[model samples]
Target: MTIRIGKIGYLNVLPIYHPLETGEIANDFSIVSGPPSALNQLMDAGRLDVSAASSIEYARHPDKYLLLPDIAIGSRGPVQSVLLLSRGPVDSLHGETIVVSAQTHTSAALLRVLLAEWKIRTNFVTGDATAILSRGERPQAILCIGDEALNLRFHPDYPVRTDLGEAWRTLTGMPFIFGVWIARRDSLDRSGQAVRRACDTLIRAKVWGQTNIASMCALAAERSCLSREELRSYFDGLVYDLGEAEKQGMTRFYRHLAEHGIIEDVPSLNFLA
Candidate 1:
């Protein structure tokens, strides 16, 4: 049986996708590409066998999915892309309406955790953050993630730019895990060998991307409309490996989500053996 995979269609995730899209690796996997939230929903519906899912999804449904070994899209601090664009002072957002991006999962929760910490309560609404970026004087705050957050064309009208990654690190003194690659346990359970092969292929692709960063950066810059220098730095900034530190961060994040009542409880991470 052929395994289907869903890839995130954001520039921040380009390095892991380069090898597959460019046909550098040979595989029989069918591809479904979309934004992070779409991919997460597809996985939830069992439409995709494997996917790059928001870390929060795994935390939310730990029993339904098994994490692939040693792969993540996380950051130590200041993920320039996940920005909280606020029209007023972030601390003064009491009673204001803050619009969460439809494309976000982890970021939306992260925002709530941060606000709870700051004792800043605001009414949350969901909307197309991309469309709202074009407007001014409405939606007092916007949580922009992925490629949309990478754009800095917003006017001075929305000047309060708060980086969620940086804020999380400052608040907890730990790195933040944004997304992770996950496979439905039943899918991998049915084909262990095939699953391992696919996992290795993606790991190799990540290695190839690190070695051939110039090509990756050029392609990413074209798609993101960011300068080569900026793309280079951004790619360099991301940590694609699920190391011990990232796990610790994930645990801390789960605790925060629970403490803030964003999630029911802290879910234990169960990885594929």
Candidate 2:
């Protein structure tokens, strides 16, 4: 059986998937693409054997998945894609409604954690921030992720923009992992070799991607509003590897989530052996 892998449809993930798409790394696995939240749901529902899912998904159901080692979507600081855009200062948005993107789970949770850290409480509603903004209806704030955040990073309407990754780094002094590659536990049990092979292929693809950032940026520029230089800078800040520091950051995030009742408890990082 072909291993079904899910890819996040975001430019931030271009480095990893570009190589695979360009035949830099040859593989026979079936790939599915969607936003992180959709991929998380696919994994949860057993429709996907493996995926780069939101970090919160694994924290929510660690028993159902085994993490693929050495690969993640993270940033040391200033992730340009996961942003909180507010009309005024974030601290002053208390009691106001913030429209959150329906396509996010981890970023939304992280936003709550950051707001709580600042001792701010704001109401949240789920809607399409992009559509709302296009219609000239401004909510107090909007939490955006992926491509939408990149496009709105410099919007004139929201003068105050906060990069969640940067905020998390400031609050924790470590890299923030937003997405992690995970394999369904039962899929691994049934097709162990295929699952491992897919993981190895992803790691190899990531290696090629890390070395070819310029090429990736060139390809990404065609589909993005950002210039190549901006895309290069954006890619430079991203961390694709789950190193020791990243693991520590992820654990800290999970602990905070649990403390705030965002998740039931901190989960053990169960890697595929």
Candidate 3:
């Protein structure tokens, strides 16, 4: 039987699954890829057995899922893939519009927290970029994530960019976790060892990808239509594995979620062995 695994199809996560994509893992697993929010929706609806969901999703539904330790899509500094493109500076954001993409859950919340702390009040609009850009005036900043963020770099139409992950770190002095793998607790109990093996496979794949980044970048370039050098830069600048800093950031994020009543309680950072 093939184990169904839903993964985020973004470049930041490319390195983590490089080994699996290259057939280095012997396990019988089917990889389905999608955006973080979509994957979380699938996991919530039981359409997927396991998925790399946004950490906020896992925190929201802690009893239903188990976090896979030592593995995540994180960035200690500038995460090129998750960015907020602004037309003007932060100080000028007041009263100006900020368009938020529908593909995000954590970044939106994080932005709100930062804006509150920084005392930068602005009208937050949730809609499509095309619709927002169609107006006579565009938002002061447009929040973009996943492939859209990467694609924005090539367009040069958006002049200013702010890496949301980096911004959070600048404000809070902590790393940011955007995504994590979570197994259904019921299914995990039935096949605990298999779940652990899959998690191990992901960890090993990440290490191998980091060690052999050139080859990984080659594969990514072919897939993304980006040059090897450009692709390599994306891999080089990202932080793939979850460490202590990310754990602290995740805790803080969960606390914020709890404060907003998005979640009833803060989930312990529990991971399957």
TM-score: which candidate is best?
A: 2
Candidate 3 Cα misplacement greater than 4 A, ranges: 130-137, 154-157, 260-262
Please write out the lDDT profile of model 1 over residues 1-273, one tens digit for every residue: 778888988886677777887798777788899988999999998888888999999988887898888888988988888998887889878989888888889999999888998998889898887676556436778888888788852646678999999999999888898999998887877887887788787788777777888888888777666889988888887888888988999999999899888789898877777
Evaluate residue 49 in candidate 3 and report its C-alpha lDDT on the 0 to 100 scale.
69
* Predicted candidate 3 versus true structure: per-residue lDDT over 1-273, tens digit per residue: 356788787776777676687687555778988877788898998777677888889888888988887888878878787777887677678778788888788778777777777788888878766556656556668888877777764445567787887888888888888888788887787777777777777778778778888887887777786789988777776777778888898998888777767678989988776
Prediction 3 TM-score vs. true: 0.90
Q: Name the better of 1 and 3 by TM-score.
A: 1
Alpha carbon lDDT at 46, candidate 3? 73
Model 2 Cα lDDT, one tens digit per residue, 65-137: 9999999999999999999999999888988889999999999999999989999999999999889988989
Clashes of 2: 0
lDDT of 1 at 206: 78
Q: Which residue pairs come into collision in candidate 1?
A: none
- Report the number of the highest-lDDT candidate: 2
Against the true structure, what is each candidate's TM-score? 0.95, 0.99, 0.90
Q: Model 3, residue 160: what's the lDDT?
A: 78
Model 3: per-residue Cα lDDT at residue 229: 92
